[model samples]
Target: MVLRDPLRGLARRRARWLAVTAVGLAGFVVFVVAVAVYRLTAADPVFDRGDISGLIVVFAVSLGFAGLGGLRLRVLARRIRDTASENGFGGWLPAPSAADDDRRIDFGAETGRLRRTTRRAAALVLVWVALFTGGLAGMSLLDEAAGELLATGDRVPGVVLSVYDPGKGTPSMRVRFGSRTAKIVRDSGHHYHVGEAVTVVVDPADPEHVRTTEEQNENQFVFGLCLVALLLGLAGAPVAAGAALGWRRRARAVGVTGWRVATVDVVPDRSIGGRKRPPPTIHVRYRDGTGIVLRAVLSTHGAKALADFTDRLAWVGGWGREMAVLFPQGPRRPGPYAVPAAAKTPRAASAFRRSRR
Candidate 1:
């Protein structure tokens, strides 16, 4: 299907977006695999568990799904626009395919926009990296604190050791670190010598490094969580960048019909009324400058597909309904990107169609 000019050509641009998404997916895969390997090999109980594997799997799936979904969208948008072109007169937009073949869509601005997301994502990843570093550093600090407590060997004056509550409870000095406090308990038969200072025998090299210490090994998971967060954050950078760029391009090409902005908000099932299959969704709402609101329910495919194809619609006047064809196999070109604003004034016949449809 072919439209007059601009409307017929959006499919080509969508192809470009698919390419960008592909690169992002590849990057994400590499990142996840790298992290998984690191953890699997570390032989750290914290890293080698099934939970870590689950996280890795989730991360990989998100990347793969996003990439494949993007590819599909581009394809569908291309198809929709191409087919719509041959059908009939489009409202505000000129058939984009009618544009000169050599005039590529202005992707430079789009590319820059996408890069901004990378910067933001990269900064977040950097923060995670810092957190991971801090965790390692903290282990050493913990060892120092424990060692200090242990140093007053046997008995030190004015010192008290804490122990689990007994039938006739022994007094325990509270060990507080910031907000978290742990009550040290006498390991069975051990009792504090009178006036003996209670010290934790912690290795100086590692705060977590302890010998004859009474702390649980469960704490190592904290470092593991930090490590996972770091990996996920870093892995997401490229995908974020690609998505941002794609949106920026759409905004520049086709401003939404009667709406200034759009967003794809995903919430947990519990948050949205326990939706079993992506519920209370597939909706489009429009608000006039005043308080009037216009909305309609959309198909699930419509919801996902529309998010990326904002640029490829022919707007109806007054009512401002934009025609977007929904499809599961995307990369469907819904249209030549919304007609350029400069060329958007509808002809008499299109105006008539707008009034009627």
Candidate 2:
């Protein structure tokens, strides 16, 4: 049976993700252009049913693609175990060199950083929830009140008798509705001159109740604000959740005791664009008690610190998608210095057990 190379698989996955991300971004640009053209060219720019439905579909599909691409990118950032290499014992014959015994690590500083990250993430989630809920409630109340007024009122043509500035508030206008004159606040951006004929909605049960066609449509501004709030909440929820999960995993890994000896290999960065790239990912491979070779990806900062030591090995610790490396001397780094495989094995346990000896 032919065995698959884990490194080769990772390369292929990265390429596929890059293509997917490009397509998603292209779709978003198209959606934006379509909206701008539609609004600018139309005489009455209000979105009809068909227009709204089509826009929603396009936006949702584009968002889904972008979200999927991001998820795949995250997966590629973590460390993965290479099981195929275990079958061939020859591949694990020579162990990597270890770090100097005098290496220093600042565990306290790292822990503090993680704590701050967790708190920030929690606070962001709460803020978004509050904004989304308040906006939705306010919009609902406004719509209900407007609906009631429209249902109980009658439409009639009224002549504007006079227009005056209220001094303390918006401009006001007096309109005669079938011999009964009532004062109303003029809607913003709408001008009313004396003797101008306008359509008014009035309730016979309450003679004082009067509203112009323009007034009824004024609620559009409030609706727009609510829609913005909802969109922000939707977009921020995923980002906050992802940050929380990542930090939590790092905290757990840092809490683990003991360290293991592992060889570090730098993965070639395949990121697009000519712009400067961030730190490259390092692959850490080690053999557990079962003699299986397990691999994990080191964090960006950790990769930078260990760049010169690619020819040698280093001291690694932690379990699952969270691991850290110790150098002879480098900047103080946080937990989750690296991410390992999810599969539970004697790999991490045995490595730590040996550290005690």
- Runs in model 2 deviating more than 4 A are 1-60, 80-123, 154-157, 161-193, 203-209, 217-357
Predicted structure 2, TM vs. truth? 0.41
How many clashing pairs per prediction, in order?
49, 1
Candidate 2 overall lDDT versus native: 0.54
Quality of model 1 by C-alpha lDDT? 0.38
Please report, in order, the local distance difference test score of every candidate based on alpha carbons: 0.38, 0.54
How displaced is residue 49 in candidate 2, in Å? 8.4
Q: Which sections of candidate 1 miss by over 4 Å?
A: 1-68, 84-160, 163-201, 204-245, 248-357
Q: Give the distance in Å from residue 117's predicted Cα in candidate 1 to where it truly belongs.
A: 8.2
Candidate 1 positional error at 350, Å: 13
Which lDDT tens digits does candidate 1 get at residues 199-231? 444444554433234432223445456446546
Error of 1 at 246 (Å): 4.0
